[model samples]
Target: MEIKFGDAKYYAYTGTHDPASDLESVVFVHGAAMDHTVWAHQSRYFAYHGYNVFAVDLPAHQFSRGELLLSIERMAAWLNQVIDQTVGTAFHIVGHSMGALIALEAAANFNHPDAGLNSLSLIGFSYPMSVTPQLMDAAQHNPSEAYSMMTQWSHASAIGGEPVPGFWSAGMQLSMMENSTAGSVHTDLIACDNYAGGEAAFVKVTCPILFLSGMRDKMAPAKLAQAEADKNNNAAIVLLPDCGHSIMSESPDGVLNELKRFIGARK
Candidate 1:
């Protein structure tokens, strides 16, 4: 479904099998250069099992139309606008990678008072999400090379394991990056590198927070996420073995099971 938020058209996959009313809304935010399709399995599963799912395409990414927001704070604000325009109230939220950082900031600085958040799930995240200078330079000066480096680091192997069988997952990631605007990945990496609000955010989060970390993730490792998870009283951490940073794809069933249990308990 498409919804107008200012001049941009935001696309969300509402459950194809269910009605759009009386069900609690769950918004899924994708990582940098990625669209709502990353949550393909989880979103539909929740919607089919009785929930209103909003797996969103952020501005300037695949389906959403607008200039890229450039910073985590701005993206978080835009996400708030998305929630206000669509669900208009209390909702659960899930985010991956860069999206997880955005969700953390949003939960810390929630704008809606009367209709507060229910719970938050963050996948593949780390506080002060530092990026290597070599990668940053590649993203800025040589995007194609940066994309290549990203693909190399994203998957467990060159062929990847069963995220979307019969297709090259690493190649798929490279293709997906092409859908983003020029320098979008660079901007996202910069935003993640500059963000220092995780410590402040976790302390203020009043609702439940679940962190899913991949044991084999080369990008954002399990220990980094676990350290952040320890800061919050309501936070709990889960580690998935034999999984890479692309937990949603690398370990789709594991992610869904964790989400099912986390989201299910609140409902």
Candidate 2:
């Protein structure tokens, strides 16, 4: 689906389902340098099973056409505008990696007694999410190296084999990053590295929150996610064993099941 905000046009994958007023909404936001396709498995399932799914491509990341928002706060604010224009009634947000940070900020700002933010699911998240200098440098001057490093680190193993037939997890991720808009990876890394409001944002969110961590994650460690979840009274953590930063691809079924149980219970 296409949504216009001013002169810019944004693309959201609706799983081939049209939006309706009666159905609840679930928005999926992907990590840095990634697009709506990262949520392919989870979003399509939710859309097919009676929910309005919006797997969004952040501005300048993929099909979305606009200048890239350079910080987490700006991205969060843009997300709020998207929700206001597209979603009606109760809604839930599912986000991963960098997107998780955006979701946190957005929920803190947008969720209210009558705002209809039913729940929040943060996957591959950590507070004070720092990016290494080496990775940042690579993203700026040697993007292919950055993509290779991220792809290798994102999964438990490069050759461990994916559950889906005829698929290579690491290769697919690398391709996605390679295909992203030029300099977007560095832009996203800077946003994650410089953001200092995560702890404050976590406390502001009042709705139930899910911290979905990958046990073997190298980027945002599970321990960090646990610490943040520990701070929030309404937050819970679920660890995906043998998975890494890319939980959606490495443990698709586990991610989907947890989201179903968490959001379904609230409904």
- What Cα-based lDDT does every candidate model obtain? 0.83, 0.91
Q: Write the per-residue lDDT of candidate 2 for residues 1-267, one digit (tens) a residue.
A: 999988999999998888877888999999999999999899989999989989999999899999888999999988888888775468899999999999999998884333488899999998899999999999999999999999988999888668798888888899999999999999999999999988788778888999998899999999999998887889999999988999999999999999999999887
Write candidate 1's Cα lDDT for 1-267 as tens digits. Answer: 887867768777887643355677888999877888889889989888878888888888887788888789899988888777665246888999999999988887777644678899999987778999999999899888888887778777675467555856566678888667887889888988998887887877889999998888888878888888887778889999877787887788899999999988988
Which candidate number would show the highest TM-score if scored against the true structure?
A: 2
**Alpha-carbon runs more than 4 Å astray in model 2:** 111-115
Tell me the deviation in Å of residue 96 in model 2: 0.2
Judging by lDDT against the true structure, name the best candidate. Answer: 2
Q: Over the full model, what C-alpha lDDT does candidate 1 score relative to the true structure?
A: 0.83
